[model samples]
Target: MFIKLLLQVVYITVPILIYYALIRNNASLKRYHSILLGIICGISILLCMSFPISFETGYIMDLRTVPWMISFLYGNISTGIILTIIMLGYRIFLGGIGMFVVFIAYSITLLMILFYFKKYSQFSFQHKMKSVLTLTFINSLLIVSSIHFIFGFSESHYLLFYTVFTFMQLLLTWLTVYMIETFRENDRLQLEMQNSEKLYIVGQMAASVAHEIRNPMTVVSGFMQLLYQSDEIPLKHKEHVKIMTVELERAQAIINDYLTLAKPQADKMEKIDVKEQTSLISQTLSSYALMNGVDLHYHIKSDENFYTFGNPEKMQQVLVNMIKNAIEATLNKKAVTISLSKDNEYIYIDITDQGVGLSEDEIKKIGTPFYSTKEKGTGLGLSVSFSIIRAMNGQIMTTSDMGKGTTFTIKLPQY
Candidate 1:
């Protein structure tokens, strides 16, 4: 009788210990809540072991299952370990050598499987589901086989208990996964809503500027044409008319640039050779660089071609802004280098200038409208460039030292 009492105490204590251990690494839950879960499990296991109610047929009642039920609900390694240890202790105290050996083996296996599932299978929903199913199947087999073979218990009595335990555990496991997926969906929805709001604000600002400039642009173009046609106009006046035409064209370009920024959208993407695209931009800008005393240097990391799906025109705009900035910054410098390269899945375009580099604070403010340091800078160039890159699902990053050179890096997804 004393031995049986000691055996029951060991069985009840093991499950509680396992529950405590599982929660040791989990700091997200409140301390009180974790403690409460362990205490409840311990009490439930203890009650199941002590209650002395045998069936009318004289078949032994099994309260030994309470701890396993707790283990299934928790599904954590620490809880499983405690349950196994407590069960093992109880069986030894009661001098049930066969039952003790079988329980120890099953407990260790279950704990190991649980640990592995948590590590590798936690990253994806599908993996988590498969792992849970595998573990449930193994656990069910352990309980049923132990009762049938090791304890020599009647199959008819314990079979119903095992089936009901499996069903309850399956339901609990499904609920846990479902709750986590719901949280992930909510986070994704919030991000989409914020992006939509930003786009709406940008569109409103762009429309106001376009409305203000269209009439003035048309009047200046018409007046310049009249002055050019009048033969009586002096040479100097003709020269003035020519200047008006050029300035009017520049204003129209500025209006178009602003419109692009306000109504930015994803480009029509196609897979193209990234290296070739970079080469073309460098070649096109080469003449402008020479006239301005800016030497262009192009570098490719390897001889192989790189490919990505993107809008070629939008990519050209991004490259042009970066190169123009480099040229303007390096006014009297000896040379500037435009390096192009690729790794496994990304294409990098770096424009380095030997001229005076900007301070950290200046670099941070570059993407904002009207933030240019140039005497004639509109500040909208870099801002428009930023919008274009983002539309293409790419990023632009910059690094600069106050007196040293500055490097601009543009990264695009490669096919």
Candidate 2:
């Protein structure tokens, strides 16, 4: 029985090991991950049910619930339902009164899973382990009780067998959950490392080429300014020069963003008054916002000043970048509001805009270099802003509803 139960453990875990192995380096396969997980769990269910641990009392047991529960908890509702159908269909093919009992027991288990499905994905590792184990215990008890009552198994040895079976079910469930969580954590870390490597490569390229590129651009910009001001030049040519000047300035801004990412300076840290800085940025951008037909509003929820530790200049840059984006996202006559509040740990700066908001996919790509929502944007402003805030040990969070608007929240630890 021990060896058979050990084989059941292998039956339950082998598919998980194989699935992760295949997808470890293939990012494109990640899109079909949940479906793949459902399929693999289904395969495990078939294997476990085929070689179930049978007892002399004509009762059969298997580790099918381990994969079934995992599919529901980790995958979506559709996956869970499909797996349930598969399990029931296979059991009916086997043809026993136990099939009906199995359906009823799993129906109850599925209902319990549905009750906790939404919140289970967000639980901490420990909480997830506890929840899955607790559910498994209840499920095991239900199955054992149903089998005992229906089959009339009154043998003393049958009780001991059930006890061992229940213990093995919980043990195997715990192990499977642990392995899955470990794989997930490792994947997360690998992704973070990949992003960091990309950032480093871009930073190096920017550091090497930005200065060399800036020198000629600066000289050309100076000459363009001279021609724009030259009275001897034809008016049409001067207008062309003015356009060139504007384009040059725009290019310069892009270069500045590259430089910001290229060489992140360790600025002098100081206690910054977030409220005062936010107010200052609002005033500075007021003219620009007015020209865009967007109204700028500020709300202070507390009378007390919110102080945080950071480079004051960098903090202001993040504020200006975020607020400017907010204003641009807002349509003419719409308002962009900046609100400030603080708690014991962190100060929050929320810039909310009233405009056509971003989609979920667009929001995810917000800080990626060279990606932007605007037609002519460089996409480096937010990237630079993100880098600056991270340097100061702060976080930037975004929330948006399509056709409504978006909010960018900057959270900085209070000094």
What overall lDDT goes with each candidate model? 0.65, 0.85
**Model 2, runs deviating above 4 Å:** 25-28, 56-58, 119-123, 148-162, 208-256, 259-368, 372-415
Q: What is the Cα-based lDDT of residue 192 in candidate 1?
A: 40
The residue-by-residue lDDT of candidate 2 on 1-415, one tens digit each, is 6677888999889999988987786866766778999999999999999999877756668989999998888777899899999999999999979886787789898889888655565455777888899999999988887777777666785677679878999999999999999998897567557655766787998889988999999899989988888889999999899998898898888888888887555558888999899999999999999999999999999999799888888888888888998998898899999999875567888899999999766776787778889897888898888788877777677777789999888878788
Q: Count steric clashes of candidate 2.
A: 0
Model 2's alpha-carbon lDDT is 0.85
User: Model 2, residue 308: displacement in angstroms?
Assistant: 12
Model 1 per-residue lDDT tens digits across residues 1-415 = 3344344444555545544455444534333432455455656555654553344434333344444544544444466567656756666665644564446546655565655644331224565566665665566566556655665656676766556545644554454445434544564456445544654576577788687788878987998899898989998999988988998898887787778768666457787677887889889988888888888889987888787777777778778888888887885646779887765556777888877788755765676666798898887778778777776676677777667688888777777
